[model samples]
Structure formats: C-alpha cells, structure tokens
Target chain A: MTDELVLRLLARLHGHAGWLAVAALLHPVIVLRSPMRRARGAAWASTLLVSAVAGLGAGLYPSYRALLKQAIFQQNPTVGWWFERKEHLAVGAVTFAWIGLLCHLAAARADSTSQKRLAALAHRAYAAAFFLALSVATIGTIAAANRSF
Target chain B: MTARSALTAASAFAIVPLAYAAQRCVEVGLGGELDPALVPPSPRIALFWRVGVSLVLAAGSTGPFYRLAERSPALALRVAEALAALAFGLLVAQAVFAP
Candidate 1:
C-alpha cells in the first residue's frame, strides 16, 4: 500500500484498537475481587486513563468520546472539577488505593518488629509520593485549562 | 497498619513515577508529537500522555497495586516491574515499531 494508505490503515486500526481495549476492559468488573484479576483490571484501567487524558487534551471536549475516555480511567467525576474533571482524578484514586493497600500489607505483616518498621517507612514514602503526584496533577490541570490544548 | 504494610503501600505509590514516565515515552510515539499545523498540537498530545500515565497510576493504586501491596510485598514489586516493562514495551511497539 501507499504511505498515505498505510498511515490511514494504521490510524483506523488504532482507533478500533482503543475501542476494543475499552470493550475488553468493561467485561472484567467481577475480576476486581481477585488479586490477580484486580491487577489486570487496574492495568487496563490505567491504560484507559491514559487514553482518556489524550482525548481530552486533544480538544475532544465533553462528548461521548470524552465520557468513554474518562470511564477508561475509572469512575468519580462527581466530587469537583479536578476530582471528577478528567484524567487527573486517577492520581487521587491511585494514591488512596495505594495507602489502603499498604495498610493491609502492614497489618498482615505485623508479626515482626523489623517488618513493622519497614511498613512505617513505606507509609511515609507512599504519602510523599501520593502528594507529589497530586501536586503534578494540579499543575497539569492548571496548565491544561490555561494553555489551550 | 504495621510498618511493613505501610512500606508496601509506599512502594506501590512510589512506583507511579516510573510508570508515568514509561507511558509518556511510548504514547508520544502514538501521535503525541506535533507537526504544529495539525488540528491538535504535539504539546496537547504530550499533556494527554502525562494524564494518561497518572490514570494508569491511579488504577494500579486502587486496584492492582493496592491489592498486591496488601497481599504480598514481593508481588507488589513484581507488579511494578511488570508494569514498567509493559509500559516500556508499549512505547517501543507503538512509537518505535509501528508505522
């Protein structure tokens, strides 16, 4: 095929792939209960989140595309503009989830003093990282609003 | 929660940066780069890529990372490694190899 034809074909394929990825993602809600399934779900959700952010940033605006794109990240655009606004919301969700996960792990591993100490250290680091992600997300949101992407 | 649990959570959270970076590098190849005259600029795509990475981080944070961190610290690390590899591979495949 010609270069233009190839490009067009690739674009078409990618667009379909994105949608298919979304479809596959939708069928696994039950899997979230299993750690392994949740892992895959989370991965797919993250991938969708990336896809949604790209759509919004590209001037896709608030259409079905945008809604579908946002769904790719995970639900929760109801709190506020930033929280439920767009892709940035994922940061908050991820941070919260990580903290909860850490707590669970620590609770399970509390049999050892050394393990407890490590858990404490992990908590500090996780909190710091979550804050950093939120800060970056906030900055990105500001930039997106002002910069005209 | 105990110290070890906290650490596991922290490790899960800490992996975000690496995952985010991996997504950005690859997604840019998926047409994040700009020709300036296109309907959307490259910067917009780049920004989208950044947000996308965060989304992935969030999903993992809540679902996979959280579960892994809670269930097994070692598995959590493995998950991070797997994610990094997946992100890197996506970048290479989509940006580096795809037409």
Candidate 2:
C-alpha cells in the first residue's frame, strides 16, 4: 500500500484511539476510589488505549510533518503551537496511565494497608492521566479539524 | 508491592518530564535552526532529539531505580511522588508557555 493511504488509515485509527484513551482513563479514576476496588482491568485498558494512541501518533508523525504541519501553521500559528503542546501533554497522559497501571497491579499484590495507599495513589494518577488525555483529545480534535491529511 | 515493580513505575513516571526537559534543553542550546519545523522549514532535528531522548531515558532508568528501591522503599516512594509532581508542573508550564 501507498504511504499516504497508510497514514490516512493510521490517522483514522489514531483519532478513534485518542477518544477511547480519554474514556478508558476515566474508569480507574472512578473505580479505584473505593478501597475494595482493584480496578486492574480498567487500569490496563486505559494504559493500552493510551499507548496504542501514542503508537499510532508516532506512526503518523512523519507524514504529519511532511504534509499537514506546514499547512496548519499557515492557517493558524496558535493552533500549530497548541498541537505542539498537545504532543507534550500526550506524553504525560500516556506515561501517567502507565504509572497508574503499575500502581494498580502493585495494589493487587500488597497487604491491606499498603494496598489502600497504592490504590489511592493509582486513583490520583489515573485522574491526572484522564485530565491530560482529555486535554490532548480536545486540542487534537481542534487541530485535526483545522487541518488534517 | 515489590521494590522492583515500584521502582520501575517510578522510573517510568519520572522519565517523562525529564526526557522532555532534556530534549528541550538540547534543542535550544545546540541549534536555533532546529526549533520544531515551524514555517520556513530548513533542516530540523527537533523531532529526532525529542523521540530519541525519550526512548533512551525510558529504557535506561528502570534498572538503577530498582536498585534504589531495594535499598530504601520509603525513599523511593517519596522521590517518585516528588518527581511526579514536578512532571505535572512541567506539563502545565510548557503548555502555557512553550513557543
């Protein structure tokens, strides 16, 4: 298949995955609040979703730079900058989701007192991830709408 | 939680901001031409540095951190939390301020 076609497919999947990541990240934020809640499943889902989105973004990036980036900058420099910051925050969103996943897994193995602490930490981490991913998704949507390949 | 797992998580979390900060510093310090391919795009290395530094740090930090965790779990947790807070602050500052 052609590179353009590949990038288009990746762009489509990335857009869908970005939204899925935002939604998946919210699950542990709510679910892991209770001391009894493990949330391992939701935690893993969010991590995978965000990671997948990031991976897809990586695959699409070269094409993005060659094709859409200059055009977007020409249209609106502000949105172009927003896209830059969004990429940075996307790093945070994906990384925090990973941290939350590790924490959730550790929480499952820990003793009761330690488990609660770890789960609470995971809850906060997931919340942070959710907010960042949400911001990334919103900015990304605007950027794509403004100019996409 | 095991020390190894805790440290791995901490390393992964801490590296995110550290990687970006390093990448930014190198971009600014080394060359002005490579500032993320804005308009009159000349030869740019910003994307290469960004991806390369992040990959290296994320891959390299876990082993040393695991050793640290083995020595002192309390210290490891405290350091990780501090680093995570720093990471959060860095994100906000960059989002609001980066050109």
Candidate 3:
C-alpha cells in the first residue's frame, strides 16, 4: 500500500481506539461506586476494553513511527512533536491500566477493607489512564488537522 | 513511607522525565526538529520547564501506584517498580545514545 493509504488507515484506527478508550474510562467510576459484585463486573469489562485498546496501539506503533519520521523530514515538526508526546503518554496510560487491572484482581481476593483500598487504587489508575488516552486523542486530532501531507 | 510506597513513588518520579527524554531521543535521533513554539528562547529555561512539568506530572500520576503499594502484596509493588524503572532507563538510553 502507498504511504498515504497506510497513514489514512492508521488514522482511522486511532480514531476508533480513541473512542474505545473514552468509553472504557467511564467504567472505573462505576466500578468504584457500584456494589462489590457489580463493581467486579465493571472492573473486568474495563480491563478487557483497555487491554484491547492498548494492544491495538502496540500493533500500530511501527506504522505510526514511520509516518512520524516522514513528517519530521518533511519539516512538519509540530506534528512530530505532538505525536511523540501522545505516544509516550499513551504508553504510560497503558502501564497504569495494567496496574489497575492487577489491583482489581487483588481486590477480588481481599477482605473488605483491603478490597476497598485496592479498588480505590484501581479507580485512580483507570482514571489516570483514561485521561492519558484523552490527551493522546486530542493531540492526535490536532496533529492530523495541522499536519502537511 | 513504607519501603514499597517509597519505591513506587520513586519509580513514578523517575519515569516522567525519563519518558520525556526518551521521546526527545526519538525526535533527535530521527532528525526531527523540536517545535520552536514549544522550545523556550533559552536552552536552560527550556530544559527546566521540560523537567519540571514532567516531574510534577509523574509524581501526580503515581497516586494509584502509591495506593496499590499500600494494599497489594510487596512482590507486586516491587515488580511494578522494577518494570517501570527498567523501561524508563531503556527509553532514556535510546534517546541519548541511539543513532
């Protein structure tokens, strides 16, 4: 496929991933506030959702890097900078999401107080991850709009 | 602070600038120009803002990690810290030394 076609495909994939991340962010709050059993379900759902998104991102990284290199050489430094920051933050978000998932699993096995603490931690991590995803989405949008092909 | 919490906090603190620097490495290594608008007029000032903002964000981002350390098994916290530190180190090395 031509480079332009590949970039277009990646852009669409990024858009879908961005929306999926936004939806996943809502689950953490529900998990934190819901009753224990329901919260567990929410946590599981969010974990799977975020994991899928992260996986998609990982798959796309190589293409994204190539396009970024192209942009850099083309003198669209703004797009390059935005994309670099977005990818780094997205990786960080994924890290937090995994930690949150681990915390959720621990909560499932723990006593009430311990469960609460773990759940709280999981909530915070998920929230952070969500925001990071949003930042990535925003930056990506800006980059796409302003980038010179 | 418990050893676990301290370690988590430290990892969080360290990862931010490391990540930022690593990204810089990717840009510079790739021969990408830094956005002039984002770069301060002075190199020292630019570095200060970059490091300062990264540190603050990194510390704040670790709230969950700290909480996790408080309640999770010690092994879990240790593993997380080690992974984060290793990733950050590699990224920094890639940024600074990668051709």
Candidate 4:
C-alpha cells in the first residue's frame, strides 16, 4: 500500500480503537459492577476486545511514524515533539490495556473476595488506558492538522 | 490477589518502558535522526538519555504501582482515574493551544 493509504488506514483503525476504549471504560461501572454472571462475562469479553483494538493501534504507530517522518518530524520540531509524546502515551495505554485484560481474567477466576479486589483494580487500569487512548487519538488529529505535506 | 497475578501486572507495566526504550534505540541505531530543531541539540546524546530515562521510569514505577494496587485497590483506582483525567486535559491543551 502507498504511504498515504497506509496512514489513512491506520488513522481509521486508531479512531475505532479510541471509540472502543471509551466504551470499554464504561463497562467496569455499568457491566462489571453488576452481580449478575452474564454481565460480568460481557465485561470480560469487552475488555478483551478493547485491548485487542488498542494493541492493534499501538502496533501500527511505528509504521505510521516512519511513513510521516519527513512530512511531520523533519519539517518542524514542535510538531515532532507533540507526535513523539503522543506515541509514548499510546504505548502506555496499550500496555495498561493488556494488563487490564490480564487482571480481568484473573478476576473472573478468582474466589469472591479476590474477585472483588481484582475487578476494582482492573477497572482502574481500563480507565487509565482509555483516557490515554483518547489522548493519543486527539493528538494524532492535531498533528495531522499541522502536517506540511 | 495471587502472587502470580501481581507479578504478571508488574511485568506488564515494566514492559511498557522497555518497549519504548527498545524502539528509541532502534530508531536512532537504524539511522533515525532526532529533529535538530527540537531541544538538546545532540541527537545521539539525547537518544541515550531517553533510553536511560525510560529504563529508570520502568524500574521505579512497576513495583510501586503493584504495591499500590495491592494495598489499596480503591485508592489505586482513584489515583489512576485522576491521572487519566489530568493526562487528557494536558493533551487537549497542548493540541488546541500549544505553539
């Protein structure tokens, strides 16, 4: 694929991932908070899906950066700083999402007391990850606005 | 709750900085230049410094975060949520207003 096409695809993926992250953030409160087995199961499934999407977006970032090196990084320093910082934040988000997934799994298998604790922590991690993902997406949009080419 | 799960969470957090460090090293080692227009002025030195910083951050944060979660899950969750909100605000400001 052409560089432009690839960038566009990645951007779209990032956008969708950001939206999913937002949805996933609410699951801890809406779904996981429930005492019902079915709700907890749905929460677990949503966690996995959100993590996968966030991971995919994070994975594609390097390629996007490499492609835009000249147009974004080399052309201006301020924009480069913003983009680099955004990338770092995205990495944190991706890592947290994975960790959150693991925590969710552990929670599902835990006994009642442990399950309660793990679920709480997992929800927090998910919140952090979602916010970071949102930041990354917003920064990407801003960076694109500043692109020279 | 289990030792194994705690270890896994800590490891996961640690990997973030390691991955970032590796990416920065490769970017520089593979002929990626730090934009001279940015601060520090020396790309090679800046690259090494960044990698070192990342390593230090990973080492410093992983254990503390794990402990925090273990000791006070509620507090940990509150802190994480607050930080996330702060991060969001900062990024939005930077994007919308920063020169």
Candidate 2, which segments miss by more than 4 Å at Cα? A1-5, A111-113, B1-3, B25-45
- Residue A129 shift from truth in candidate 3, angstroms: 1.0
lDDT of 2 at B41: 52
State candidate 1's TM-score: 0.33
Which of the numbered candidates is closest to the native, going by highest TM-score?
2
lDDT of 1 by residue, A1-149 (tens): 77546544543443444344334333332333332222333434533543453443344433323333244223322222232232333333344334434433553445443444333433332333233334435544443333221
Task: Assign candidate 2 its CAPRI class.
Answer: acceptable
| Chain A TM-score for each of the predictions | 0.31, 0.93, 0.79, 0.70
Docking class of 3: incorrect
- Which candidate tops lDDT? 2
State the lDDT of candidate 2 residue by residue for A3-98, as single tens digits. Answer: 778777778789888998898888889888886786667887779989989988877776787787777777787898888778878878877787
- Model 4: per-residue lDDT, tens digit, B1-99? 563445345344545545464555456457655444443333234433554565566566766767776776555545544543443344344334432
Q: Each prediction's Cα RMSD?
A: 14.5, 2.7, 10.0, 7.4
| Chain B alone vs. reference chain B, TM-score for every model | 0.45, 0.68, 0.58, 0.46
Computed on alpha carbons, the lDDT of every model, listed in order, comes to 0.41, 0.74, 0.59, 0.57
Prediction 4 TM-score vs. true:
0.57
Q: Ranking by DockQ, best first?
A: 2, 4, 1, 3
DockQ each: 0.14, 0.44, 0.08, 0.15
Q: Write the number of the candidate with greater DockQ, choosing between 1 and 4.
A: 4
- Please name the candidate that would achieve the greatest DockQ relative to the true structure: 2
Candidate 4: misplaced stretches above 4 Å?
A1-3, A33-63, A74-76, B1-33, B36-99
Candidate 4 per-residue lDDT over residues A1-149, each given as its tens digit = 88677667766776666666657656654554443233445455555666676566656655554455445545776777777667656655665665565556666665576566566656665666667667776776677777622
- The docking category that best describes candidate 1 is incorrect
